[model samples]
Target chain A: DQQVKQNSPSLSVQEGRISILNCDYTNSMFDYFLWYKKYPAEGPTFLISISSIKDKNEDGRFTVFLNKSAKHLSLHIVPSQPGDSAVYFCAAIMTGGSEKLVFGKGTKLTVNP
Target chain B: GAGVSQSPRYKVAKRGQDVALRCDPISGHVSLFWYQQALGQGPEFLTYFQNEAQLDKSGLPSDRFFAERPEGSVSTLKIQRTQQEDSAVYLCASSLGQGGWGLRTEAFFGQGTRLTVV
Candidate 1:
């Protein structure tokens, strides 16, 4: 069973607009959520993360919102640039229980110029 | 190296052959993890190490897979009698602390080695 799910396989947004990608999880034990951005032929890089204790965390143009009660989270990129186009993966981990991370299938975001 | 490094960026092994993949973590990082990623899928955990001791390996697919980090800074994942299903990208990541809590310190990943078993 997949503990993490990114139902949307792909999303498209125009440059200078806001792009939102959503993810859901079934495991309640997950306390930390992270977003990683990956380009073709490279390893995934950490973008932003949110601890379950917080509802939102932002870094420059990237912001991650966590809704623990709903077991859902979303990543928002404001003024999306063409360079932001890539695959975004949502990952979850139990803070002190397990060292491994469970990742979603990923959502390919295309920012059109 | 300034970042995590993996060798043999690409490898093609015949079925029943054995292959070994290597990883070099950051100079002072204390945690190392290995994950396998199939096409169109996210990375799955394979094993984890704290210093030179392996703490978790429940994610390894089978007995053919084995990993060791004798020096704590370098690790090797070896697969024996490879099968077609063994084909996937192997990624190695390292963090500056220990255990699950250490991951909060930001795990840096290597480029990953793509293995194709024919």
Candidate 2:
């Protein structure tokens, strides 16, 4: 059973527009959630994270909204640029045992110029 | 190294062969983790080490998979009797904090080692 899921395999957005990527989870034990961006032939880099205590976190043009009761989260990028094109992965960690991160299948986002 | 480093960016092995994947974490990082990513799938946690002690190995797939962090700096993941299904990209990541669940330490990753079992 997948604890975290990114149902959309891919998404496309126009530059200067807003791009929204969604994720869902089944496990309620997850307390910390993170988003990662990965480019071709490179490792994933941390983008942003949110704790369960908060409902939203924002950094620059990027914002992450969490709905704990719905078991869902979404990443919003305003004024999306071509450089934002990449695979986005959503991961969650429980509050114990080294906090092993559980990842989703990932969503490929393409920002058209 | 300035960031996490993984050796043998690519590896090809035949069935029944044994392969070892190496990971060099950032200098002074206290937490190390190993994850396996299959095609079109996200990375799955395999194991974790806090300094020299392995705090978690629950994610390891099977008995054939083994990992060690002898000196608390470098880690190696070994697979005995490779199978075709074992093909995947093995990723290594590290954090600067000790073993704490509530701590929000960011983990940095390496380019990973792609393993192909023929």
Candidate 3:
């Protein structure tokens, strides 16, 4: 079973617009969450992450928000740029013990100029 | 600093052939992990190792899957008598701490070794 899920398969937006990617999980054991951006033929690059202690975390243009009760999290990018076009993956990590991260199916985002 | 690197970027093998995939983690990193990603799907955990000790291997699909990191710097994942279902992108990631520090440290992923079992 897929513990983490990204309902949207793809998204498209214009430059200077907003791009919102969402993720949800069924496992309450997950306490930390992360977002990664991946380009074709390349490995995933870490974008942002948040611990359960906080509801939101921001890194410049990337902001990640989490709702513990809802078991959901989202990544918001304001003023999106063409360079932002890529696949975004949401990962939920169960901290301590094994720290095995479960990832969502990923959303392919396209930013057009 | 150099990031995680995986070898045999692309490997094509017959259904019954055995295959080995390699991963070289970042220097001084204490944790290593392997994951498998099927086409159009997210990555699934395969195993985890802290130093030379394997902390978890519950995610491995079957007994044919074997992983080793004898020296603690590099790792190898070997699949014996592979089948068509074994075809997937095998990903390796590493972190500074034994377990992912989450907010403080993020696991760095390699480009991955794409194995195609005919």
1 or 2, greater by DockQ? 2
lDDT value for model 3: 0.91
Local error of candidate 1 at B23, Å?
0.3
Q: List the residue pairs that clash in candidate 1.
A: none
State the lDDT of candidate 3 residue by residue for A1-113, as single tens digits. 88999999999999999999999999988888889899988888888899888999999999999999998999999989999999999998877656678899999999999
Across residues A7-92, which tens digit of lDDT does each residue of candidate 2 receive? 99999999999999999999998988899999988989999888989999999989999999999999999989999999999999
Stretches > 4 Å off in candidate 3: none
Q: Across residues A20-80, which tens digit of lDDT does each residue of candidate 1 receive?
A: 9999999999999999999987888899989999999999999999999999999999989
For each candidate in the order shown, give its overall lDDT on alpha carbons. 0.93, 0.92, 0.91
Per-residue error for B91 in candidate 1, Å, reads 0.4
TM-score between model 3 and native: 0.97
lDDT digits (tens) for residues B1-118 of candidate 1: 8888998999999999999999999999999999999998989999999999999999999999999999888999999999999999999999898753324487888999999999
Among all windows of ten consecutive residues in candidate 3 chain A, which has the lowest summed lDDT?
A: A92-101
Model 2 DockQ reads: 0.68
lDDT measured at residue B15 in model 3 versus the true structure, 0 to 100: 88
Q: State which candidate has the highest lDDT.
A: 1
TM-score of each candidate's B chain against the true B chain: 0.96, 0.95, 0.96
